[model samples]
Target: MDWNELAMELQKEVSGQVLTREPMARHTTWRVGGPADLLVIPDTIKDLSATFSFAADHALPVTVLGRGSNVLVRDGGIRGIVVKMFRGLTSMTIIGEDVVAEAGCYLPFLARAAAVHGLSGLEFAAGIPGTVGGAVVMNAGAHGDSMGDVLVQVEVMDSSGNLTRVPAGLLQLGYRTSRLMDTGETVVKVYLRLRRDEPVEIRKRMQANLARRRALQPLNMPNAGSVFKNPANASAGQLIDRCGAKGLTVGGAAVSEKHANFIVNKGRATATDIITLMEMVRRIVWDTFQVHLEPEIHIMGEG
Candidate 1:
């Protein structure tokens, strides 16, 4: 379908905001991407369902982005529609000892809310960036803890528009990976089960984590969290650091001196620059230690 005709049809079906040819750089953390042909932010769950149906009816490709934290969109623009869950789709409530958060809610927001309510299990996620949907799909974690540990259940919409609530046990979460990540399904919401702890203690723990993050990570610059996953029985950052990659640079992308696994955008780095630097790290690590480093960050779009 043509852009105008498709826009009219979507507007008639759902009362949500839609923007044409939106620059994807503004949406991602990396701050280096082209544009999305169509960007749709559905106001509610029903609106999201309708948008999914619209895409299916027109046979248009759709990408569901959360807070756009982990993705590295390529230089070439994305074709078709980009569906984002933010704004009205975000809703949180207390369910027994657990909190049910909509996909759009940011992880830090939820962590603060949980701390305020004396919920202890989520303290580890206080420094984690991204939305609940992205966190669940990636099994996002920090300080040696992951969302997979606190997640009780999650609701997802498959490619055919089938929504299902799967228990935590069925999610098959591993180190930085999950079934959702492999399938590319849209995560609607999550029900997390946390323990009740003393509010003062929870706050203290969260504060400590935040301090450590600031001291160790290069938060002053723009970069994806960790560039590579740690190989079994070895630390990726330590390996890279020992291999003299700490001062490495390619165009505007540089390997962070503070933490070796992080590649910071020193200035106006292209996606190609980041890719080249990542390859250099891989080659150096493999040649030095006979260990292949796998990237943990998700790289998307056409290069």
Candidate 2:
């Protein structure tokens, strides 16, 4: 089906923010992608469900993005529809000792909310820049704590367009990956099991974690948080650094000096530049260490 016709039909049925030819640069952290054919920001679950039904009926390809923190959109943009869940879907509540977060809730915000309620298991996520859905899908972690450790259950939208709640044990979270992404399922909510802790202690731990991230990560730059997955037994950043790939520039994209695993957009970087830099680092690291690096950042669209 033609995009304009589909968009018009969607506009008629869906009550949500819709944009045509939306710029991907504005939707991702790297800020270097072209425009998508259509973008939908559903404010409510009903809207999201209706939009999904429409796309499924039309056999349209769909991509759901959360916060745009750990993804890179290519220069050619994405085809079909891009559905982003952000502030509109944000809803967080504490049930007993568990914190249930909607997909749109930011990880940091979730951590802060949990801390405010004296919940302690989420302290490690206070420094994560992605959303709850993204964190759950990727098993995002740092400072010895991971989502796999705290998540009790996840509510997900199956490929058949049904939302089902699954136990965390069924998620099969393994180092920077989850069954959700591997199986092409969309996570809509998460229930985190947490313990009661001193509010002051939770805040202090979050502060320390944030300080450590600030000291080591290139937060001030426009970049996907981590470009490559850590190797089975070693760090990708250290491997890239050993190959002297840090501070190397391709156009305006440079391997970050602060964290070699990150490729920062230094104003006006094309997606091609990022791709080139990534390839260079991979090649050099492979040559020196015989370890092929895998990308942690989800790369999309085209360039």
lDDT of each: 0.87, 0.88
lDDT by residue (tens digit), candidate 2, 127-246? 888889999998999988899999999988865668899999998898888888877777888888999999999999999999998999998989888899998889999999999889
* Model 1 / residue 158 / CA error / Å: 2.1
Q: Identify the runs in model 1 with alpha carbons over 4 angstroms from their true place.
A: 1-5
* Cα lDDT of model 1 by residue, 23-104, tens digit: 8887887788788877888878787888888888888899888878888888886778888776647899975578999999
* lDDT at residue 268 of model 2 (Cα atoms): 93
Each candidate structure's TM-score, on Cα atoms with residue i matched to residue i, is 0.96, 0.96
| TM-score for candidate 1, residues paired by index | 0.96
Candidate with best lDDT = 2
State the local distance difference test value for candidate 2: 0.88
Give the per-residue Cα lDDT of candidate 2 at 99. Answer: 86
Overlapping backbone residue pairs in candidate 2 total 0
